[model samples]
Target: MTDKERLLQYCLRQGDTHIIFGYRLGEWCSKAHILEEDIALTNIALDHMGLGNAWLERAASVDSEKRSPDDLAYRRNEREYYNLLLAEQPNGNYANTIARQFLFDVYSVLYYSELLNSADDTLAGIAGKGLKEVRYHYKHSAQWVVRLGDGTVESHKKIQEAIDDMWRFTEELFEMDETDDIIAKSGVGVDVSGLKEAWKTQVSEVLEKATLSLPDHNLSRTGSKTGVHTEHLGHILAEMQYLPRAYPDAQW
Candidate 1:
């Protein structure tokens, strides 16, 4: 692939992760345990959508076919998407949702912070705008993790289970490939592998404060960036793309 192709794919991967993750958060719109939490999750979801759109638009800017962000988001099948495996997993419960958000939030802060100095001006500008929100997102999710993990017996058990289950997927957040290599060489992308240890340290500190154990597993799930994914992504796409696919020419 050409350099622009690599950059396009890199942007698409980022766009996919945030859009899918944001949609997952949107699922909790009216289902949250309380009203205040409901608004908080909704606002976070909106932030994800905004950030995802920016990345997708970045990809569009580099596309040979001149695709729009909406086209990239809604016209693609599951195999065309590059979101992390963790983003597509079901939000089983409040704790599950929070656990997923906490893990992603931590990674976002680290990843975006690195992007702040990206050689690509559009990407650096996007990072500068989004990093503020991501830091707040990290704080919000981390606090909840501490609260639920250290709360009553039942709450603690649920949050701990959520943490353990989600830990394996965390590995993919730092996976690096040639697209990363090519882009990073050109100073436009991050070698996320370098971010793994810091991710773990930040995660480990939060888990400790929450009285939760950091999962130690030999196995890790991966490959979504290269179009591989679990079954859940199909379901997410079915719902997210249904309207746009069904009404291809409809205008807002």
Candidate 2:
């Protein structure tokens, strides 16, 4: 594929991950255990949506077909999406949601940090703006992880379970494919594989502080980069795309 195509795909994947995870976090609207957390999660969800839209704009700018970001986000089939498997996983419980967010935020911080200096100006700009938000997101989720993991007996158990279940999917965040190879070679994409150790270190330190043990596993999940995703993505899309699909020509 051409560099434009690779860049477009890269932007869309990051955008999709932000949008999907934002939607999952939004599900906690008015549902968080405490009032402060309820508002905090909502605000964070908005940050994700805003970041996603920024990346979508980047994608649309470079797309050969000149597809609008809205069109790409709402009009594509599940198989056409490129969000990470970890982003698409169901938010089982509060702990599950926090665990997923924590892991993703850690990766996001590193990913954006590297992207801040990308040869592609658009990507670099987006990263520069997004890095600040992701840092805050990481802090929020990491604190929650520690709170739940090191809190009461029940809280500790549930958060530990979340850590185990979500850890397997973390591997995919660092997976590289031909698209990544081509884009990175051209200085527009990140070689995510190189970010794995740093991510592990950040996660390990947080888990230790939380009094949680990282699971030892040899297996990891993949395929979101290639448009394959878990069933949860379909459900998320169904809900997220419902209004646009049902009223294609309608506008607020």
Candidate 3:
């Protein structure tokens, strides 16, 4: 309701998306077809975890109660999470994972780069570190998208299918609402809606090189802005938060 409340929500939304997507990347550990890629995904996953935690810590700092970052992440129910719908989608296959990663990486690179100018110093600092990390992430995923998309026919088909599957969720990345309205007015938020055209152009160029067709859909997956999410988020939270919830007093 208040500006501070909206900023806290903004931080939480960004934090949730990063943490959830980091966990998704972690799912590839020991599961990637190649060992090098397995390590790469894990490292990226860790980077995401750090980035996520930074935002969560900032969110906690903003909270009147001064909650811990873990308290926010490990204690919240699915409905309380505000991650992008794209971030929480399942990793169906290597192609599927790459497709998902490619899309998000592009957006992440653009998103964080712009956030470098945020009016809030802490958020800008987070963006500075996050920008360096995701730029590498984008390069990695973008190359894979091209390699698979332009490779064998089977590879192309699978990658294309993955793209189509993930395309429906892409729109959620740029949706502006009360949170953005509040935060952007304070100059603490990047106006993501303004990034859509650039995102589309960069995406189109990559798809062109990959020989992949751009997917056009009349509808997109939505609801993340309002704490609405797909069913997968519940399952992810069940595993991720199980330890904290089960052993609230346990000290490791």
* TM-scores for every candidate against the unseen true structure: 0.98, 0.97, 0.98
Candidate 3 lDDT by residue in tens digits, 76-150? 999999999988899898999999999999999999988999999999999999999999999999999999999
RMSD of each: 0.8, 1.0, 0.8
Q: Residues 80-115, candidate 1, lDDT per residue (tens digit)?
A: 999999999998999999999999999999999999
* Cα-based lDDT at residue 138, candidate 1: 95
For model 1, give the 10-residue run with minimal summed lDDT: 214-223
Runs off by more than 4 Å, candidate 3: none
lDDT of each: 0.92, 0.91, 0.93
- Per-residue error (Å), model 1, residue 157: 0.6
- For residue 147, model 1's alpha carbon misses the true position, in angstroms, by 0.2
Give lDDT for model 1.
Answer: 0.92
